[model samples]
Target: MNAKMRNDAYSIFSEAIAAVDPAACIYRSVSKKDNELIISGEKYDLSRYDNIYAIAFGKAAISMSKAIEDVLGDSLSSGLAVTKYGFGNCLSKMQVFESNHPVPDDSSVKAGQMVHDFLEKTQASDLVIFLISGGGSALLTYPRKGITISDIARITDSLMRAGATIDELNTARKHLCSIKGGGLAKMAFPSESVSLILSDVVGDPLDVIASGPTVPDTSSFGDFNEIIERYEIGVTMGIGGLLEDGLEGVIEETPKAGDYIFEKTSHYLVGNNSLALQEAEIRASKLGYNTMVMSSSIVGEAREVAKVLAAITREERHGVSPLPLPACILAGGETTVTMKGNGSGGRCQEAALSFGIETSGLHNVLLLAAGTDGNDGTTDYAGAFADGETLERGKSIQLDAHAYLSDNNSYAYFKETGDLVKTGPTGTNVMDIYIILVDMF
Candidate 1:
């Protein structure tokens, strides 16, 4: 396997993900008009719906809400946009609630209450414009009847560090929450609902995007209980009460396929990781590199995937595989990283550091791994990049890539080496985007 081509490919791929910033994309997608909103090929005339209101939540909520405000500023009767802390900006007509991520905090609980309050006052003639995207799950969190915010936060963080899949984690979340799993949809019932989703989940399952607050639940309490037991997670009495209610048919079930709540509801998947990958492919091809989009929903442990991809690139470069030199390989998906240390990096950073150490300055090889959400793990940097020179750069500063990887501190390593990719809150999330560009034959 030729090591250099593999390294260069990965580096170029990272650049490609960084190229199409989501905030810029959202800004471009929206424009203002007097009585209409044109979003992702759907044209909604404000006059058609008797009453129009906005409800948006996610990592990209601030930017997405901004776009919504521009289009439906005067027409919107009331609206709420919730986002993580430190990402708020001014907006007209809509309340911007800055909250927390990866786990729901008190602000998240308040945001959930706000949603409930708003929906409680809604009428059948009202139109609810649900602007949902990745991170909405964490942003729209509300504990069930008896659960506490701290309990939710602890469970969420533990599940994340335990390397649970997003679906598994969300399944648990849906059961524990009052507004997730179709609970919001239940509240918005009998109203005209329109959900515009920027999917971060692989395959863009409607039920999995933001835990499908406005969608039906195919997984029931039994399924949720199974996952909890499998993970050995503690469930509070509040969650237990909800489960009992569900079992006894005391509370109404979430909207099913033929539910009346969906009578006037429609869902649009505006964007996804695959779209981002396709855009990257076209751009790389235009840049004179042959591109292959591996998978938009790539999932696995970050380091293992990085090493496997490295090996594949090496094989391709040595003329043992089909693709020739100067090729670009792309992958988009959320990778998991089990916390083995007090590392300060996310999956993308860990992947980058692992790739950097394994490649060890092999000429012509570079890699970039980053989350599409703009924040990777606990760091502000979206992700990190590494090439043939990355290891050498680490050595010059007496930095041990291996040690950093052990501690899961790729953010520190990449920051010291000046390879961290920074894009503040890309108002969209499809998943992580990875690009592997091979420039050296």
Candidate 2:
């Protein structure tokens, strides 16, 4: 391994993650002044409210709640947070629940009930400070009257394996759950609420991130049906029946673009992939590398994205764009992986494997693709690293990179090559980071 170059890649990525630190993001957007609660310049009078409550969920749940609690202090009457298991923490005043991610489990139902109870008893004079981040869609959930967690899990897991986009999945989720698609915001009706969000979805679409717990949802039953048909998803948790009733005017549509339910509800994006990429750009420049922060809105299949990135690196190395030597190219966003084989890798690892294959002879360039949350898909590592010699090393070990990529088993390939990037449980979640370091040497 080229320790210096690899360390540089990790350095830039780390700086990016720090810039979107959940705690810092919360502190930047929220503050307490005299007798007022200020959020992103909007103030809600504390005098009118009997108590201020804070609740957050996602990978960033713990750090975010800590910042909120610090700002509110003793004035923070109560709070709660839900995060993926092994990421929970002990807060001074708020309760924390750890749940499953990417798929809702029974504990997710319990966490949903906890939030339900919190919102159910809220009075008109009370205020809710909500902290929403990536992964919340599964970390916090309450099924509709008859939908069980297993039902929700089956639908979600199937869609994910089928490569359904986050928006498509959230659209289906809205119809089946009572708490998604603005349902949480509705529950906080009559009480003023503000949500601080750390976006992980591509394009930062408000309604898609964490299924838009606080924002008004524009997707309807019709939209849900469209996604099901589009993705060819079967067994939609009886969402067809709900959409049928909705189309027949029996079930009320989800809160629309301009609903009174959102009158006092405010949503602010505290952190996003773009913000993280910008920070990475700054760090790379300081390290004597000519940095180009590519689009943070990158979206596509993992291997295809890898092919494009590798092509760009090839172009730069060959003077196509005439980029300066020692170039650091970075892109950020979430990518999808369709499970074609019983694979053992996530999207980032797959991308890394593809990159290694594409850059086999381009000696002197290195690439690292990793999830900011420190967990990639269902794997134990954040992501993986690759370079020109990766394929050669694999062949030396009697491993085949192309076969692994075909099987969606990139994790095993990188493991054998000792190239998996493991940063366990980073407390923040923005999106995935892809960095390519090109050196003339």
Candidate 3:
């Protein structure tokens, strides 16, 4: 491995994450000016509202809540924040709830109930501040009537294993949950609310971020059904019954663009993957590499994406690419993994391993792919690194990169080669970052 390039990769990744830090994102958009509250250039006259309450969910919940507390101070009534397990922190003005992620458990149900109950206490004159970020779809789950949390979990797991996109997964989740798909906005009806969102979804679609609890949902039951059919995911009996009810119009659809419930609701995107990628480009350029942001909406299967990136690395190395040697290529967005093997690995790790195999024996090229949330799938590591030497390092220990990749065991492969990038609980999520560096010796 090229030690300097490896270090620079981590530095660039860290800078990207810092750009989307939950608290900083909030502070940039929210502020107090005497009897008025300003958010994203819009002013809210504090005297007109009876109370100002806050509700936050997703991986950035606690940090975002704290920033709100600082901005509102004693004027802030009370607040609730629900985050993934181990992402919670003590706050002076708000209660924090910890729950499961990538899958919702019983605790998620409880948290959803808590949020619902909290909204019930609000009056028409009150102002609700919603702090939303990635992971809220799973962290703030409330199964619809007749559907169990286990059913939701099972479907979530199934769709994920089948490599469903975030949009597809959240579409299915929104239909099953009472608190998602503008359901929270519906529940807070009559109360004016503003959502400060840190978008982890590509293109910052308000309706898709954390399932868009405060925004109008463009997806419909028909869309959810299509996702299920496309993925061949089998629904539980209860879910199947609910789907039937939805299709038959026995149940209410999610709030739409013209719904009155959205009249007083406003949403502002405070941070996103593009913002992070911009910062990464700056950092990489400062580090003396000719940096270029390849894309900020990268998607598709992990290994397939890795193949394309590996090809770019080769092009850069041979002086045939758009960017010359000593070039850094950056791309930010989420990717999926179709889990055919039972082995453990996340999208980033899987991509890194595949890139390693394709670039084996090639010198002066390195890649790092990691989640900004400091986690990748169920592993402790955020992601991993791959360099020209990655495969050879594995061979020295009798490890075959191809075999591990076949088994979907990138975690083990990277762990053996000491290439895992671990940064525990980064307190933010704007999806994943990929850094490719090609240097001319």
Q: What is each predicted model's overall lDDT from 0 to 1?
A: 0.78, 0.89, 0.93
Best by TM-score: 3
Per-residue lDDT over 1-441 for candidate 3, one digit per residue giving the tens place of the 0 to 100 score:
999999999999999999999999999998899999998899889999989899999999988999999999988999899999998889988999999998999999999999999999899999999999999999988899899999999999999999999999899989999999999999998899999999999888999999988888999889999888887888889989988888889999988899999999998999999999999999999999998999989999999999999999988988898786699999988999998887898999999999999998889999999999999999988999998898899999999999999899999999989999999999999999999999987
The candidate, 2 or 3, that scores higher on TM-score is: 3
Off by over 4 Å in 1: 1-48, 237-253
Per-prediction backbone clash count: 15, 0, 0
Model 3 TM-score relative to the real fold: 0.99
The number of the candidate with the highest lDDT is 3
Candidate 2: stretches off by over 4 Å: none
TM-score order of candidates, top first? 3, 2, 1
Superposed model 3: Cα runs more than 4 Å off: none
What does candidate 1's lDDT look like per residue over 1-441, in tens digits? Answer: 235444444445444444444444555555546776776667667677788898989877777777766666678787898987887777788888888887888889999999998989888878898888888888887787667888778878878887999998888788778788888888887787888787889889989889988887777777776766777777667666776787677866555677766677778776777777877787677667777888887889998888977876666566676776777788888889988988698999999888877776466666778787778988888888776577789889999888898888888898898888787766567788887766653
